[model samples]
Target chain A: MADLLQTPLYDFHVEKGAKLVPFAGYEMPVQYPLGVMNEHKHCRAKAGLFDVSHMGQVLLTPKSGNIEDACLALETLVPMDICALKPGRQRYAFFTNDNGGILDDLMVANRGDHLFLVVNAACKDADIAHMKNKISDTCEITVVDDRALVALQGPDAETVLSALIPAVADYKFMDVAIVDYDGMELWISRSGYTGEDGYEISVPADNASVFVSKLSENELVEPIGLGARDSLRLEGGLCLYGNDIDETTTPVEAALTWAIQKARRTGGDREGGFPGAEEVLAQFENGAPRKRAGLLPEGRAPMRAGTKLFSSENSSDEIGEITSGGFGPSVNGPVSMGYLSTEYSAEGTKVFAELRGKRLPAIVTKMPFVAANFKR
Target chain B: MKYTEEHEWLKPEGDVVIVGITQHAADALGELVFVELPEVGTEVEKGEEIVVIESVKAASDITAPLDGEITEVNQDIVDTPTLVNEDPTAAAWFFKMKLKDASEMDGLMDEDAYKALID
Candidate 1:
């Protein structure tokens, strides 16, 4: 068994009687005493506080006047439009490798003069190493592990955030801001994994306890663990990094081609060379063989990951596999998303998943099974 | 009344045995939220895990006390899991299974013996 890692809020979780479970090498709270179902419903109805401090936070600043050149260089790694990223804004992007495979999907925020990146904890070391090797020494890359990440998510998240700072409300979706919450400075982003109106606040590790305690003091807020976090993100149609995308799946195959700008993808605007460019550009022209699509199982039963796929209502040849699947509390039903054959990736297309000793019927649907409530 | 080492408490009820979780087990499980009971007529071997009871924190398997076929199931706990917390031995009766080996209960720990196990 691997050794379990502890977050800055680890003691606070133990104090709240949280059931700690090993996840991504960290001994994180799987659920509190209130359980996954209740914690999930609480996030949808009221507000939920999550300790995401396990994710790595990094800062990068250009050497002199090469911010744009550096931004373009960084864009070569991920398919997202980094050059267009305005100051005080954030964008979702994946760090793709030479084969167009996702090294890790991360949130890259352009913080005024510098850059703020939040990557998955499990893949942070590899990501930093890869960035350091690829970028010029002119760029400054510093990992901010001293911060404890906390997310206040829900419709009332804004209300609590507004109380913290009046100017926070002005920030739009995927935007970042550095604000002083009392005496501690925090990097605030209007981004969350739960697909709700929420903010991911990065507080110094030393100040995490008091920050979390004070945040929970609000009557509307409650501590949520990874159990509810999974269910919530499942409902939101968000995929887990290791399960959904890995070193083999590309941006085009994952249906994230929107992140790649046309100029960079094609040779028209001096097709800047990048890793997996040839394969990705080819897939852009002649579509990918498989694509990511949402699955709506016919019955109430959830179609979990690794569940084999068939085309018949009962039995047929195998086609694809479920990547992420679970019960969606808001939908009050089970929903799933997975990679499917391009021929069957259309919305409303019928499909079947082979659950334990049974064939569960499903239909392909558009993503965001639960409507996004971004404070745009 | 006697309890199996697996934490199942059973009471003689005519030709069937009424089963409930032990107080010690309920307390350790924290708050009960959902209970998945086996269907009637389902055959269960002695010491086999026959029920899936989920609490606020985690889901646990409740093992069968003796070899038997389920005669009846209690649906009340499906909606009200706290009944196990309130009265685990009586009001929270899980199900009744007709015994294939009636002498199995004799080998289980009696009330005093079970109390010692808890202590």
Candidate 2:
């Protein structure tokens, strides 16, 4: 096997008795001694610290010294209203390919001088190459490799974080700020992937272990692992890039139309100038052939990814395939999401997942099986 | 007690044998949320998938150790799946099966050999 890369907190994770597994070219902790279910429940009720340092962080600066030029260049790559994004605010966006499929989903923060981007670890290199080849002459892209990112999430996150930086309590959801912690510069954002009220802290790589230790010192905070992270995001109805929204899946087909703001939609001011706008906007007028929907299995057996879904009315006919599925610790049952035929995408539509040679009964239910607790 | 490379353990009691996953397997799998066992009176062959154990992260299938007919299955583990994590080799035994061939036990590994293989 190839040697896996290590994050800044690799030693800390080993010290905490975390089960390490290979993920996205890094050996990351999948769970701790407390186990995945307990860690998942802890994050929902209290605060859980996660090491997300493997994600790529980049700074996009316009060589012309005009922030508008940077936004315009970004608009050509994504379908979001980058010009409308306010300073110090972050938005979720994806890089759309020529065919309207998603190259990668990312979080874009509009800083006053430059744009801050956080991309998925597995797709970062390709995303950088694509951006550089397309817009490097207009905008200078710098990969920030000296920084490490960590997330503190859950219902008690704000309260726990407030103890360290009291001013953080004033920040609302999706707010970003550059703060100083004991002479160390910290880029803190009140946003996370866990669907909980949380903060993502980008700190210097050298200080990451110290920052994580200080946060974990709080009584309510525990070190969570990737296993619970996946379960939490699954319950929140969030899509995993490679699994749920890949290069073959468009935002509209993945039910992520909300990420595309009103300004970029039809009959709006911008009127779709981004890549793949023709095909993507047309899906708004006429719905796509298939749509991503939540699946609730009737029995305890989980319908895992790649499992084929069949229409219950006619068991022999395959309708779709499960893109992501697993046991939701918070919901206390199996929750899954997959694309189904448009006709069978309605809520309460009966379906069957073929698992181990048996057609397990399932139903199309509303997504976000567990309610999001974001502090909006 | 005999062990299989797939991490299942068997304890023979006359023609009927008790079966469960090894503690090593449970530890590697983390907290189990669900367990799907084979129906009683069903015939199973060696290396066939007999049970499925699911954790919050992923699911794994437990294969049959040798050809057998399932005599009984543990309903407790199905209701409370974490029992496998708490005591995989003893209280959390998945099922009891009537062995088809007694000589099949010679092909399994002992505790020391199994420990060496995992370590």
lDDT, candidate 1, A1-376, per-residue tens: 2588889999999999998888778999988987777789999888999999889898878877656766776876776668788888898888888887889999998876777899998999999998898875657888897899999999888888777678878878888988887899988999899989999999999999998888888899889999899889888878789888898898888888777776677754636367787888889989999998899887655677888887885666777999988667678666889998899899999988986456778999998998999978
Off by over 4 Å in 2: none
Per-residue lDDT tens digits for candidate 2, residues B1-119, read 99999998999977799999999999888788889899999999998988988887677898889998999999999999999999998999999999898888988999999999999
Tell how far residue A99 is off in model 2, in angstroms.
Answer: 0.8
List iRMS for all predictions: 5.1, 1.1
What is the model-wide C-alpha lDDT for candidate 1?
A: 0.84
Q: What is the per-residue lDDT of model 1 for residues B15-48, given as tens digits with 9 covering 90 to 100?
A: 8999999888987786576677888999999878
Q: Can you list the residue pairs that collide in candidate 2?
A: none
Superposed by TM-score, candidate 2 places the C-alpha of residue A54 at a distance from the truth, in angstroms, of 0.6
TM-score of 1: 0.89
Worst ten-residue run, lDDT, model 2 chain A? A310-319
- lDDT tens digits, residue span A34-143, model 2: 88899999999999999999999999999999988999999989999998889999999999998899999999998998999999999999999999999898899999
DockQ (Cα-based) for each candidate: 0.24, 0.83
lDDT of 1 at A49: 96
